[model samples]
Target: MDTAPARDSAPPRTTAADARRGAPASRRPVLPYLLIAPTVLALAVVLGYPLAGLLLLSFQDMTRRELFSGAAPPWAGADNYRTVLTDGFFWEVLARTLLFTLVCVGVTMALAVPVALLMRRVDPWLRAVMAGVLVAVWAMPVMVAASVFRWLSDADDGVLNWLLGLLPGVDLDKHNWFYDPWQGFAVIAGVVVWGALPFAVLTLEAALTQVPRELAEAAVLDGANARQLFRHVTLPVIRPALVLVTALLAIGCTGVFNEIWLLRGGRPESDYYLLGVYSFIESFAVNRYSTGAAISVITVLLLLGGAVVYVRRLRALGEIE
Candidate 1:
């Protein structure tokens, strides 16, 4: 009776390989790589080619004349690099660049994150108004904001000086904010930080909203103080957004030229120059194409180093894990 009740033979046991073989063509692991191949190729053509050319150009003794001439660029080994690296001016400019990038990133993030947090606690209408302002500020074009800030700090009839003049014994009339290098850097810092703050605020605000309110309540119920609650609960949840914005701002600020150029006025001294400005002035203004290329290469390397540090920081915080 038991033999008669035996079930039909089961299907063959499928191994991983067999299962993969049975999957749709599009579902195969290699399909995504295939689909992205064209995009990768296009990007290589666009970015990789130019970067390779820049690297090659950096090692050669190239100039505007040599580039335009019907001859190959001269091979100079590390002459261009030596010239850039050994120059006292380049180092000074680099220091200023680091200072500028750090200040802008630090000040912007410090103010923006707090403002974003406060927005969640405020009345909805006030929060709406605040968000609108941030959006409007963020939407303003870079050049427009730069130009506006330039006008605001104008030596003659600027609104900032106008307001200062109204206060008793505090007439900042016709104050040339960009006359000194430190002061010029300060003004540029102000403009850059202000322009960047709104985006940071919005990013943090979105991240803050995604954090579960229950975690905060749970922390409070466990007798966590205000500082402890934020440090333990809120900070970890939004750490990813914080790291992302910080890295992005650091990278963007490292390449800053437009704001400095517009705000500092044209052809500022080495004291006020950042790496990008230095590269531009060396390449175009002074016709040192090879030197500029070397500077560009150095800047790229520095940025890569920064990116590595940022990644390591995130990993250390377990954000990446």
Candidate 2:
């Protein structure tokens, strides 16, 4: 007892765990903030600064000449915003973007659900093969895909025209796909949906695995067919994942440019201009930086609204707090 007391009196040595548990109240909270400060500072510099500058620029009159020259840009309070917002061209582009997003999301979800469910019930080898294909497509670079799409859709001696020529009563050799707005937009929608499906299918498959098979089995035993079982059982379980994917896809499709640009075949006067392309043209091609910034701000607001709606729906369904 004397020896023990003497040892105890020597002062308690701090272990790693002890240090963590016994960290001073003042230091503990500050330590976490200290650790995160670097990341926060980096993000502020990289993302926040640019976004703040864009917002400020949107409120100013930044013309092409001032953009090129070293002269200070003139201030035009809400003028750029008003000009961009009131422009008929901007609204048309925005409408096209929204329509494209709707088509892409609708088709992607429709195909992804079946594909995901199929992956669960398929043979091991088949499932592996399918998953590999999806992962490969999902991992494909956007630039590479765009390049391939450009090659396939080329006006002169393109594969699409060659294939069309093979069909009876048709001769589409060297046809320009971007000439017709509807046809061009439809083709774009197809490509976007194809590229987008892999991600949705893979995500849904992962989410489906978390769902209890017992519920599905119980539903099947109660005289429920495949459609009913999926409707009543699997739908609820995967609804959250579905909603998340929808929101992500909506945001992504709204800002899609690479594939659309490639499909548009570099035609500056093409009627197939979506919001993304319009913004690019204004900012870079026309050097209307403030107008482009205003468009970007509107796009951000649209995404925020989509996110808000997603959260509200999910909350209404009691999927999240």
lDDT of model 1 at position 63: 67
TM-score of 2: 0.83
User: What overall lDDT, based on C-alpha atoms, would model 2 receive against the true structure?
Assistant: 0.84
Error (Å) of candidate 2 at residue 144 is 1.8
- What C-alpha lDDT values do all the predictions have? 0.87, 0.84
| lDDT value, residue 87 of candidate 1 | 92
**lDDT for each residue of candidate 1 in 142-200, tens digit (9 for 90 to 100):** 88998888888888968888987889899687798877877778778888887889989
lDDT of 2 by residue, 34-79 (tens): 9999999999999899889988988888886786796878888898
For residue 201, give model 1's deviation from the true position in Å: 1.1
C-alpha positional error of residue 238 in candidate 2 after TM-score superposition, expressed in Å: 0.4
Candidate with best TM-score: 1
Backbone clash numbers for all candidates listed? 0, 0
